[model samples]
Target: MKEDTPPPSSPPPLPVFKMPRVHKQEYWSFVRLVAPSTEMPPGQTAWKTTDAELAYCLKCKTTFKYRSGSSASIRKHMNHEHPHELGSVGREAAVKRMKNALASKRKSSAVIFSPTKRTKKINPAEEEMATRALIEWIAKCLRPLSIVEDEELRFFITLVQTMHGIYELPSRRTITERMQAHAQQLRSLLKEKNAEEVDFYSLTTDMWTSRTTDSYIALTIHFMTDFFELRSYTLEVASFCGKHTEVRIRRKLRDLMYTWG
Candidate 1:
């Protein structure tokens, strides 16, 4: 009775593709997760600055690269290549979610933005006044000039003041120039007052070395005005590199006196 052949075996079942489960914002339903090894060509390693993952489109089987936690590139691919599948309603919803997510992130980072509010226009005069006031405050308080670039101060101003959109902070160079102008104005005023009101003047000098071993000498002049009001002004602060000899000090004072005259 001959060899009875076994029944023809059925072919193996096709692999079932499972869609990856990810954050709702990632919109993973339209794509399949791909293993990096399988996604890359043989003998080539996947290189990325961020933690990268592969995305395979369910509809087109196209591969896209994206950061591990975000499917923004995949979403972009879908919007560009398969817009018909992602209907107008779906596209709008996706855009809205993206915007809301970005706004949330900025808020968490201490930045506030108002999209619908109409901001008041700041006039040039107002802008100039604010800048002058800021400069004066920085000078009078001996605060660092870099404070104008502080992020927290910027956020605070943006959150509270409506003109933050139009008002730019003065740069370090601008501040330095303004400070020089203010110094010159004050010096001119002092010279005029001294010429009009003073009979005699007394002067004092001090020299010291700072922690960094740099030496400095300060000269201050004192006098009584016509109204008996006493005033003092620091006329010079010279950086001295050599030994602080008495002769050098007298020469420096004499040079300063001649310059002032």
Candidate 2:
């Protein structure tokens, strides 16, 4: 048998959603006033009225605006809320005064003058004369000590000549041998004169790295009398080590000191 079924009720009408309208008074109260435009560019779907206006604040100095039936409403609003912020001249004068005060303060604290003296120009002739005098003085001082002789000067001149492509200087090995012999001669002289026994000799020690990759420690002892005089001596060199320690360094120095004796 066929059964009668009630027709299905239509689904409840889909709910319609609507955005609430923003009042002109409320919008203008928060935003600064700008010129009214009849034709707003596309994508500007928020502001509907074209005749909206704004107002500017003089203190905290911000601008505010609102929409009203007449300009009386805007004037009344400004008078009620910000009566003291009416004049633009007072604000401009205050800004100018502040700027001038800052400028004056900076000028007072600035360093306008330098304290250091300027360097004077050097005269080439004077410089040359001084250098010549110094060389002559050095030569004269060494002549009495027998260190500066014609032969030694000629040897140095020849070395300079070699640099000028004239003659070759002595080889490194020859130079080393000559230095050793000179050192031995000086040591013997000190021994003969009993100068090494003097306790007030000045000593200078220096360490340098050679082109041959060897590290050398050179010690020079200058024996002088009570009278002001300089005695040149050969410098002794030795190898240095890490594990040798400070005691070993002192021992090496002692050995060097004993050599003079």
Candidate 3:
């Protein structure tokens, strides 16, 4: 036979391709209160009413201030105080009205800032401080300004918000809820620990009405600790409604004791 055929050549090895790895960038996601969509949904326009940007609370029958003068404020108040009212005559309709008013300013053609992936997380300490500030404003200072719209308060809050990246301030409703919640928490703590520390405690009770005719009854307890340190602490501050008589007062005191007992 003639020369053997050329040595069989190995086929070319298959080329291997590697998949590219995708690096995901995480951004702090939140629902932005932008100008509402182009139209208002049904039954939303009536929520547009505001007195100095404060919405009227149907439950309280009073105008309460909110930061943004937007429907979100009324909606929030409804959610916390009147959880029963939502979806039926919802504030979405009113919010749509407000957003529509502001639509001209928030143009799609306006210079848009690109979103950054490196978002600053809200500081809890700063938020708590803000909450305390809100309580001071309403309770101590007697200022019922909206958290967003108050000129003087915003100056102070803006400093904290910008410095701490806490864009959201405490809602007025949040302030009310937190005040009650914190009070309840302290009351529970005192109930659990007071008996363990004192053998006996004497109580003092008093009732008074302010210029606004809001009645208040305060109770205090005085006691000596095991270490012989004298201590006087407030036991309760309750609203005294209706007539104040010996029979009624005694019954109320008994009810109060039953509450903490």
Off by over 4 Å in 3: 1-163, 166-168
| TM-scores for every candidate against the unseen true structure | 0.37, 0.31, 0.38
lDDT of 3 by residue, 1-261 (tens): 696533213211221111123121011011112222344558665222221233333244434444443445545656676553343233444545545544543443264646662434469999799878878878777766564576666545434533436566699999899999878766766776675576688988999998999898888888987788889878888999888989989988888888878
Q: lDDT tens digits, residues 1-261, model 2?
A: 897542323211221111134233322232233434545558775443333554433233343444544445445655566543332323445556655665564464364544453323359999899768867887887645344466657555434533436665689999999999867765565565544345576788876666876766778768766566667565577786544467877878888777756
Candidate 3 has an lDDT of 0.56
Clashing pairs in 2: 28-65, 33-54, 54-65, 55-64, 55-65, 57-62
Better of 1 and 2 by lDDT: 1
Best candidate according to lDDT: 1
True-structure RMSD, every candidate: 26.1, 36.0, 25.5
Model 1 over residues 81-163: C-alpha lDDT tens digits? 87644653365577677556655645654634475543345899999998999999999999999999997787556544423
TM-score of 3: 0.38
Error of 2 at 107 (Å): 69
- Give candidate 1's root-mean-square deviation (CA, Å): 26.1
By summed lDDT, which 10 consecutive residues of candidate 3 come out lowest? 22-31
